[model samples]
Target chain A: MSSVTTTPVPRPATVARPTGRTAPVLRQLLLLALAVVVVAPFAWMVTTSLKDYADVYRPPYLWPQEFHVGNYGRAWDAAPFAGYYVNSLIMTGGILVGHVMLDTLAAYAFARLRFPLRNTLFLVLVATMLVPQFVTVLPAYDLVIRLGWYDSYAALIVPRMADVFGIVVLRAFMASIPAELDDAARLDGAGPWRSLWSVTLPLCRPALATVGMFSFLYAWNDFLWPLLVTSDDTHRTIQLGLSTFSSKYGTYPELLMAGTVTAAVPALVIFLFLQRAFIRGVASTGLK
Target chain B: MLAPTLVVIGVFVVYPIVGTGYLSLTSWDGFSEIKKWVGLGNYTRLFRDPAFLNSLWVTVLYGAGVCVAGVVSGLGIAVLLNGAFRGRGVYRAVFFLPVVTSSIAAATVWRYVFGDTGVLDAVLRFLHLPAPNWLGDPSLALVSLVLLTAWKSLGLNVVLYLTALQTLPADVYEAAAVDGASRWQQLRRITVPLLAPMTFFVVIEGLITSFQSFDLVYALTGGGPLGGTETLGFLTYREAFRLSHFGYGAAVAYTAFALVLGVTLIQWRLGGRERWSS
Candidate 1:
């Protein structure tokens, strides 16, 4: 029976004979339907963003009567979006730098080095990942105020610089590297820091990219923390700015849609270009 | 090297968690020097507060709705895109688009979709169907929130399920097919059981994450239409920031945190013992 099962027999007829004729057609049809559900809201947003007042609220929805391209400009001018953009870029950049550096150092230590309480400390770090953000933001707010960091970049960037998830991802990636490489570096008169920088760091680029992408996305998309810390437009990030914009111009659906489009496009563009890496990164990480 | 990370975590995460616990036991208005020890008073009041109870109930309902819907739809899409096919990348990309979009931006568009003269209303009018207010009615408001969240969660679930599906042994399916098993039969018999571990992960993760959903509620409804959509997270925001009930808000946050921890612990217990045995 084992010999018969292992025998090389062309099983094309058996595998494809039943559903071969119509499976692809059915699959494509189902896929197209799901795709429409995902894309319709975005289509509605873009078309409505360009509509004049009448077309926005017209009976037949989705497409506008005419393309009023000035709405983006009007929406941009309606608020301090330029300042918000600068602030967001600064905050995201600061966070990425801090997050990558700190997480890399710590992850390298956890992965390669031997120290007292190493495993225990790592377990404690892992446990922190289970705490929800809402639980921390309240006291984090109080801390921000007490530290005189409120309404400043420190409040926005410092606390989020090093996350447990990023460290876990990096540490796992680092652990896969051969111990001989660091040993080789040490034999060449390089200290631990030197080896980590010149040897381990170069090879860990892919993991670093994953960590960077996630940190960028987190810092950029974060709303609640920024909302709690920042009090005015000077330090407001894009999401906060967009929220304020919508609340202030609640009646102007067209402009609000335009503003919405503006806010969403940067992240969408990045993901579109880097989706393969993004998907793989998230998949391999296996927990979000 | 770990010092900086330890310091940051200790200052921000660990301290905040302990602080949240301590804060819950006091009565503070967020400004005064006095904490006025309440000793579980807020927790007791929380059980009786109609608004708090409503929010707790709403959160559970919304979380369950998103978890079930997101997992089912995500599995469906993953199965549809499982094998190699033309336009597979396009379909995956399109479905994954909302996951990348910020909640505020997505919620802004959804607000219009559920608005009075919005897309849903227009479609209903064309079909001559009754168009109840999507975001206006209390009951319907929660449904709309579920729809938005589940949509946002779809891409992540699809990716996860697809990853797990790819790891499944193809020979099992081949053997089942040779035994005259139908596609539906193979899925029900072989694929479902094989993917149970992933399904468990997705479900638990979905519940924990959904309980903390705040951006959509903040942007889309502001927990509004007469507090119809106030989730526990939204309620925490209202109590602490809007109402200045710092102690009470801490209690609410702690309760939400506790639920998350409980689910996580359960996942570890069941998930560990199962040993990916499926």
Candidate 2:
């Protein structure tokens, strides 16, 4: 049981020995159930969002009677959602830009450059991923206060701008780039930065897209860090803004659903657009 | 090139971790001009306090529930999907939907579903069955949370498993069949063993994500129903933010961090040494 099965050759699941007709039926049935478990709550969310406040608890119809489109408007007006959207956009956008620029440079250097203490530094950063964010939550807040950055955009944007996972993922991706490309550029007299920009960065578009999409989704979805850093309502992200609605009007299922729907739309849209790349990046880069 | 990223990470991540270690040794209310030195006092108090210990137990239980349930169910679903099937893309997409949705949003939706006589009950009623109040029951709330966590996070595991399953060679299984191996024998001997890497990958990633994650639980239960679902992460947030017991809170947070760290290191050693020996 402890042995590692090093199956280096390709295996296309030859065990597909025909288990007869019943197996396929059973498998499809199980798959349908699993799909429902994953999807039914989301469908319920949309249904509840449209239901009248009274209809939410009555029978849970698949479709609301009137399909109240006004709930979105009411949910929006219930909190400082417009301000939250702006703050979230700025916070996520700023963090994504910072992460892509910084992590790319750092990863390129870690993968390609000859630098002193490089392995030690890279290991230190990677090890931090195992360190729970809460361990640093209080001290990070103290640092924010010391810098007079409490409740400011910088507090939310700066501390998490350099992520361990980003550097690791980008480094793994960049490690695949042919060294000959760099040598070719250097022979033509391009400096390191020029070579990186002209020769290396173009090949890293897939990695960049993956990293950018992940960073954007993470910063947008984050609740705890944003909840800690920004106490000001004006600086609240969508998560904090939705929390306000929850605390005040949580029992109102329709309003909660509406608010959640509004908050999830951006990420859902992003996933719809870049899901293939997202899955490939997540599955491939984390291991080999 | 490395200077900017290194500087930010040092100031933001590395410095704060070191500072937290010192802060955990003292009792400091986040505000005020005084920091009292209470070396080992917080740790000793934390060890004895039943509430903190309970949260620790709850965190472990919750983490275990998530990893085992997520990994097993995810693998089952992935293998099923790997079969020749219609609507594979739609099934895959739907299963992966919750992974990308915001936690608050997912938790919010789940809270409604699990609320008293909520959609889950309605579904059960549609089937003419009894439906327990998942979120309101003390005995069931944590289970409910785990189910929700798995619901939201298991898609990533499924995708990983599917990716791994796709790499299996049909020829080996055919050879096993020719050698008179039954389907169960092949699955037990070959399929299960081969899937170990993906299993470890799923479990490790699941632990990291679910153990550290608080938003879904916080948003859904608020550590509810007699603190039955009170995770250490939630406890730390409440202590530091609501009570402003910054030092005590930091101690609790670091304890949770250390536990995860220890588990991860053990896993690494076990997995690494076993592979080397093999």
Error of 1 at A115 (Å): 0.6
In model 1, which runs have C-alpha deviations exceeding 4 angstroms?
A1-23, B272-278
Q: What digit string (tens of lDDT, one per residue) describes model 2 on residues A43-156?
A: 888888898998887663667888899999998888888999999999999999999999989998998899889999998998787787788888888888889998999998
Shares of reference contacts reproduced by the candidates, in order, are 0.71, 0.72
- Where model 2 places Cα greater than 4 Å from the true spot, the runs are A1-23, B83-85, B272-278
Clashes of each: 0, 9
- Residue B59's C-alpha lDDT in candidate 1? 86
Considering only chain B, what TM-score does candidate 2 achieve?
Answer: 0.93
lDDT per residue as tens, model 2, B155-184: 787887888888899899999999999977
**lDDT to native, each model:** 0.88, 0.83
Tens-digit lDDT track of model 1 for B26-118: 888887899989999999999999999899888889888988998899888999988765577778888889988999999999998998878
- In angstroms, the error of model 1 at B235 is 1.1
Candidate 1 lDDT (Cα, 0 to 1) = 0.88
The B-chain TM-score of model 1 reads 0.96
